[model samples]
Target: LAKTTQPISMDSYEGQEVNITCSHNNIATNDYITWYQQFPSQGPRFIIQGYKTKVTNEVASLFIPADRKSSTLSLPRVSLSDTAVYYCLVGDALANQAGTALIFGKGTTLSVSS
Candidate 1:
């Protein structure tokens, strides 16, 4: 299993962009690194996923290094509403696997201000 690590917190102003990076040194071949964003009371929402390259969506872009040891999540033009906890999950790619659980650690808290 790949053990993941990330920053504890970040500070950003409204309308600014933010990027959070995560490290997973022992990532397995069957494992995928996923990024999720969570607000104060809501569940973490899937942001992006990648194996060994870059993946982008309407909300964020995930950049994986060639070694697959780390990844970065880019958030464009963050706002006050974007302030939340960001988590990086590393596990099996199979979503339906009953044995797989999204183990979340203390996420990076992005504090967006005016």
Candidate 2:
């Protein structure tokens, strides 16, 4: 499995945009970069994903560099309610693979203030 590294925390005011970057230098060719957002006690929610270039949705945008070693999640006009932990996952796209369970570590915590 590829190892991911992200920031421990970030601060943003309401209506401001926030961007979190994560690094996975040893990502496999078949793996994809996925981002998840988690509130205090709830499970993480899927944010965005990308193989290369860029992928965007209503929630956020994912930017992948040419080397595919790192990715970024950009949230637009965040609110106080957006305070949460952000996670970056780099793994096989197949759901039924030998190692399917996503291994998590300390994630980046975003603090949205008014």
- TM-scores across all candidates? 0.92, 0.93
lDDT of 1: 0.89
> Candidate 2, residues 9-112: lDDT per residue as tens digits?
99999999898999999999988888888998898888888899999999899989999888889999999988999999888888556767877768899999
Off by over 4 Å in 1: none
RMSD of each: 1.6, 1.6
- lDDT of candidate model 2 versus the reference: 0.89
- Flag clash pairs in model 1: none
Name the runs in model 2 displaced over 4 angstroms. 95-99
What's the CA error at residue 14 for candidate 2, in Å? 1.1
Per-residue lDDT of 61 in model 1:
89
lDDT of 1 by residue, 1-114 (tens): 578899999999988889999999888878899998899889889888888788988999899988888899999999899999999999887855566677998889999999
